[model samples]
Target: MDMDIQPPRRTFIRQMAASGALLGVAGLSGCTASGVAEEVAPGFRHGVASGDPLADRVILWTRVTPAHDGEGDVAVRWQLATDAAMRQVIAHGSVVTSAQRDYTVKVDAAGLLPGHVYYYQFAVDGGDKSVVGRTKTLARGDAKQVRLAVFSCSNYPAGYFNVYADAARQDNIDAALHIGDYIYEYESTGYACGQAEALGRVSEPRDVLLRLEDYRRRYAQYRADPDLQAVHAAMPFIAVWDDHEFADDTWRDGSVDHKTSQYGPFELRKHAALTAYHEWMPIRVPDASAPDKIYRSFDFGGIVSLHMLDTRLIGRDQQLMLSSYYDEHRRFDVEKYKHDVCSPRRQMMGHEQMAWLEEQVSRSTARWQMLGQQVLMARMEYPTAVVMGECSPTNYCALKKRAEADPSCVNEKEQRWLSAQTLPCYLDSWDGYQADREQVFAMMRKHRKNLVVLAGDTHNAWASDLRDAEGRQAGVEFATASVSSPGMEGGYPGRDPDDVAAMMVDLIEPLYYAQTSKRGYMIVTASHEQVRCDWRFVDTVFQHEFTAATERSLRVLPGPGNRRIEECYG
Candidate 1:
């Protein structure tokens, strides 16, 4: 057995207690007790996970609970086998985990064949074994097809992770792609926690996550969920962090929700958050010194080149709020807003990352170029009236009825409002950084690659045409709904969800499909000829017993002749 050692456990425990984390652990049911009782013993309670798979290697991860308070580093043994029964052991190793890494064990199990399935598990030196986990390696050369399960925005207190459970049962999926927001940073009574008390899904710590221990405990709570664990155990995950992983609307310097007076320093909080994220997630860090540089590419056996990007924290400028452009009279200055938004100095993916992406896209020889990213990249422009809250669905319907009844009854202001000029609804998306978006479009057009953008921050399902500023179609975008977060229906209190969705599609030109109220995920299938995306939704996340159904299916063909999205028919 191989043993890896760290600093003294007593010193680490004292530091953790000083941070108030040790005191809060007792109230959190998700956290396992350190003291060994008669009924319970120290074991692998958080389950196993695998991620960031390459052609020859995959990351295996698990956590070991301490049997007693004074325990030092724990030695864990892991095995990788070709079969589930562990008869054909191909790789085995031992590693030591201590409080320094939150007792989480992560090993890069290499020496595996390309596109092969492997089962892995971990056990303490003399303890019981953990549940078996299955993972697959990326294909190296030619491949017929590739399928990926796309997910985002999984808030623990909002509801159960039924979307993950449903995706776990999918046998054909090669890997799982989590675009962002794998965990929320809110307290027990924050965003989308109205039903948390009734569902008994209160967040651990019961306070907002600001320290390293707080973030680690939150991840532990999420990993403890059977549904989340099942999905992680079923397939290797390729993930990136969004704003919620740190704080709401996090940028480079700070977050919108963070106050330096209360949190001490934003940098300290961010470092703590990143440290916990690295320790908890099964990701291969790009750079040990610079952890924020997470943008990288993965080639899927020449079929698809998946480029996972970091758009939130890397090179993003402070988001431009549309409300800031309003006057004292509550009138919006469309021209001034447009001029400021189109400034060429603004950036979304920063200079270094953008240059890297351009080089990668230009040189890739794969059949499909898929961008796995966070915000909506397509044009989601809505009418000015609709965006400014001047016109709701109910109001629009009533005005239409009145206009049909008597043409003269409708006034000029109403007509102008109805035909209001269109603008981007959320400035935090690519819409705010128009110059950067144009640069990307120019690169795609120059390369003439088969582009497919996968986005998932809105918590609502969307399918849109990727077009340039001049209205030339570049590709297509498939934005998945959140795994558990509420959608647009939550904003519009009384309007029907279907009506809101229909209204959005009618107003937004590039939008082809929309599901305003549903908790679901997307299954993207890529081939040489075409790429298809199926939006699958669960009936309810309030209960464990739920049924899933395909809400919509859309496909985009390769080449210039078919850059637009069309209904996928049998």
Candidate 2:
């Protein structure tokens, strides 16, 4: 299959104006033929979208400009049809993309049947219309089969979205799970990408995006990429934004280093980011005005009940104070905040989400229950030795972040995790927030569902058997990995550094298998007997060429715990 982007369609504005029934923002150009509620041509910056599949309904979305209000609240019409050509309109509706939602449109096209594909599109006067969108509904429990393309961490500037392009080309997939990091927050660092980089891809939006316009521009750049567009066109997506959806490591109160007052109320930007995210992707919003609450669940006909969790919004805490947590001993400063767990009051998922998750996990009856989440859920116990020994957590460690060969490299003097010698580890993640993580695990215990988590954020691929607090494996396994942004191995001038990724995994504890140098998406196939995931990679990415290939991999419980590597597949 070809992965190529054809030239843009000629501007169809004139014909659009003559479509005879232009239902534009104002109706047509606000600059009327002769005054009279002059019709303003609707804008079409953001592309079309359709999501939230129930047995009988789906939500369709779009945004309109009044040929004015760079961000307008123009009125427009939306239609969902049974045919791709819109020759037979089934359900239709209208919405105003007013200044309120940055002029975006979202409407739930309900009362449809299950296990069927549908065509949808939006239009305005002057004949302007969005590209046709295709969507499908979830099959009921007894439906034969369902497939999903799992993904996360798409840093546009880091490399080409060729993995997405490749995944889109595959056949028989039911839907795509956009785990998060859908867009990077970084602006261009002219020197940070391209040939000298790990991935041979460069970001077009190479600048920090903060305002409504900046954000809009970035999405346009990403959506324009052929590979990304192909994936969206290929399947309906179930998406939930991670912190990058707003700002890196962002939480309810603040960000890692973001100035509080400079960016307006975190809530305002959060709402804007949510709006733009929903507008540009093939997903729906719960409501137009308060779309920040886009988290929801969907079942693909009983084979699996997929719960998409929101790890950033609602109740997340600003990332742990890493600096304060760092002790002069060059170790995790356990004494710095003795017994002070980042308050349970300090949450990752808000109260509403926590309760909702428990309810969903409690009620799910699918033979295999899947949680599409962000962040590492398993307890990662790296020997204090790894970070303190040959491994340095920083690109250049000042003692720690400095180069490995510097004459003053103190880490080299330390011994590995041998008898009397032990590695000092850090305290963050589920380890740091054991109480909260326990709640999730406890919920899993209460339910009989066989759980599997698909995650992203840390630009590394990992496979592990997840256990609840009591040490009983939740019968859940996680297939989480690195960014489409950059590789975990960083810049190591080498032919190919497979050993680096392997070494890091070997050094870190509780990890069954991993690959940090490669970049790609996973294809998961499950049946009553086993759930299989293939980690496919693109050999090259920087130069807009697709050479993605799956070198090797691992798997987890086949309807039961103790994961074993499939020697043949391995």
- The Cα local distance difference test for each model comes to 0.85, 0.62
Candidate 1 pairs with clashing backbones: none
lDDT of 2 by residue, 176-195 (tens): 78788887766567423554
* Residue lDDT tens for model 1, 1-570: 111122122332234335432222232343442212223455766778899999999999988766664468988999999876667999999999998888889999998999999888888866667777889999987678999999999998899998987887775688999999999999888999999989878888789999998998888888777678777878899999999999998887888999999988989988998998888889999888999888989899998999999999989998988889989999888898988778899999999999999999999999888999999999888777777887875677667668879979989988987666778858888999899988988898999888899999999999999999899998999999999999898788897888889877777789999998999999999988889999989888999878788778899999889878998878
Model 1: what TM-score?
0.91
* Candidate closest to the true structure, highest TM-score: 1
**lDDT of residue 100 for candidate 2:** 61
Flag regions of model 2 displaced more than 4 Å. Answer: 1-46, 64-75, 85-89, 98-103, 190-207, 261-267, 286-290, 322-346, 389-416, 419-431, 480-483, 551-554, 557-570
